[model samples]
Target: MVVGARLEGIQLSGIRKMFELTTERSVNLGLGEPDFQPAQHIRQALSDAVEKGYNKYGPTSGISNLREALANGARKYRSDITANDIVVTTGSTQALMITAQYLFNPGDDVLLPDPGFVLNVPQVRIAGARPLMYPLKQEHEFIPQVDDLEKLVTPKTVAIYTNSPSNPTGGVMSIEDIRAITQFAEDHDLWIVSDEVYDQIVYDREHQSFLGDYDKVIHINSLSKTYAMTGWRFGFLITKAPIIDKLSILNYYTIACPNVPTQHAALAAMTGPQEHVKQMVNEFKRRRDLIVDRLNRIDGIHCLVPKGAFYAFPKYDFNISALDFAMECARSDLICTHGSAFGDAGEGHIRFSYANSMDNINKGIDIFEEVCEKIKG
Candidate 1:
């Protein structure tokens, strides 16, 4: 066969599948990217860097100042986080990919959240490993249960992935849940890969991270969601210092090095005016409120209020499967991701990203209601 067997069954992400189907008139909400542009200062910094002839291959571990800035930012989670602990990657996604490739071996099992980020499953498989799952139940507000995790663990299990201010569900882990996960990882002697991309996007309470002084904790984060820097593709990983050196070698071979201009831009984002982030969070909270209220207004839907991130995963009483419902919405010019796209536990639910505007979300919800009415009839 022309294609490699390992990549044979892996399909394009369900979110992207819906996203590619959308037209300008589609009232799209399929993707999770921020609607806002990167902050002005950040943009200017990029332009300045490019104009100043800074476009070159940066250090494989990234520009030292940028790494230092990220390390400083991470200090909030663990006071000891420093430049020595960071390996800047193309994005948080790459950090995750490197982690998977660097650690997982065939026959090893990595426990993932069943309704977790799509990357969590594919990355491990791509590394020639199996992904075991623990359900993130709606009843538990989408938090993983330690008992459930323990049930999935065996001699083969190597690591676990956790996301806070989660993507599809927007479930920010409660402090109790955070403690439970941390303790569980400690007990099992498993590596805790924490994805904190939405760390600064919380609504209700503070985002408590899994990045505390544990050496086994591999913390992955980026400016994509936080500063609307997805296009910049700047992110970093914090782990044991030795592991940072190891991942940096893989990072060098994978991308050679992160682009220089963007590293400067990311540094500006890190050090620039704080008001933009605060303002953005406030706006997201308002959007979240609007989307939840409108989603709950639909006759057969019940939306769980998201305390963080920009997506709403709403459960529906419709007889149709989540994929069919989402496709029906898309056919009707409304873009959404099927709940099952998240995982099996997400069935009967649908993910709507409100990262667009209030006007677009209103239009999408109207299309959703129209679809519901036709199906119910």
Candidate 2:
């Protein structure tokens, strides 16, 4: 018998290698990474830190100043957090894993949205827990239904995973929706692991989170999207004292600590001039509007204008599988992620990332239109 079970066929390296192979000649839009570089101030901060010999390992949780900046940033959404309740992780990915590891047991059920972030479901499974999916209807703009979520809970349910300004779908759950879910979790005594990495990139509406109202919420965010610091791998998690302590101990054994230089860079990003972030969000909004309008005009494609984030999840009329459509687009030298890669509920949809230059966005849409027209014919 196997001594221990390992998570099979779930390596990020495999996906990355496939992406690298396809991107060599393709106009790649398959990644969630921002196309922009970190701001000059952030780069200078990291350089200065390196010059000053700030390369030594810091605390397992995070450096003092960076933790303070993270706490300050969290106050905008919910003012209940302090540095003591924060654990700076390598990225939101690690934060999610730590939460799953500590909160879940074998055969425990963790609820996640259908068509959710692909890695999250597998992460729950790898943590020795069963993943229970709750459907987010297209008619509802892909927002989580509180009633549906409430129905999925059982004694085996340990936590619920939610992403606002959600991946692939670009769905931002409203404040009221968040309140309902949090109340349900509170009533059920379950943990709410919310991924708010795209919280600052919202377009039409304000971003909301449950960290302020509920103590059982574990909020994870990063500087990757908003600050264009994906390569920096800097993220932080906020939870109540007990959960923070639990995650911190697991983090200590997993990665030991996040990079010192990246921590300094994140501090600069949090405390730096707000103008850069505003510029990026404004630019993304422009791209988003352009893409949504163009997609709406196309035959057989129905796209909901996203309120937050830089993605457009649009349904196509052709009965072909989402993977087939995505592959067809890739064959046409235009790259986008297939909805089915997210989950079964994602069938008949495709995700378009607008994290490219305006010129690329226009060209990419043209290519997509041409390919789609051919298919319709």
Who wins the lDDT comparison? 1
lDDT of each: 0.88, 0.85
Worst 10-residue stretch by lDDT in candidate 2?
A: 12-21
Q: How do the residues 184-258 of candidate 1 rate in per-residue lDDT, one tens digit apiece?
A: 888888899989899999986889988875678898999888899898888889986367788999999899998
TM-score of 1: 0.98
Among all candidates shown, the one with the greatest TM-score: 1
Model 1 residue 146 distance off true place after TM-score fit, in angstroms: 0.8
TM-score of each: 0.98, 0.96
lDDT of 2 by residue, 154-180 (tens): 898988899998987999988788888
Instruction: Itemize residue pairs with steric clashes in candidate 2.
Output: none
Clashing pairs in 1: none
Against the true structure, candidate 2 has what lDDT?
Answer: 0.85
Model 1 scores worst on lDDT over the 10 consecutive residues at 237-246
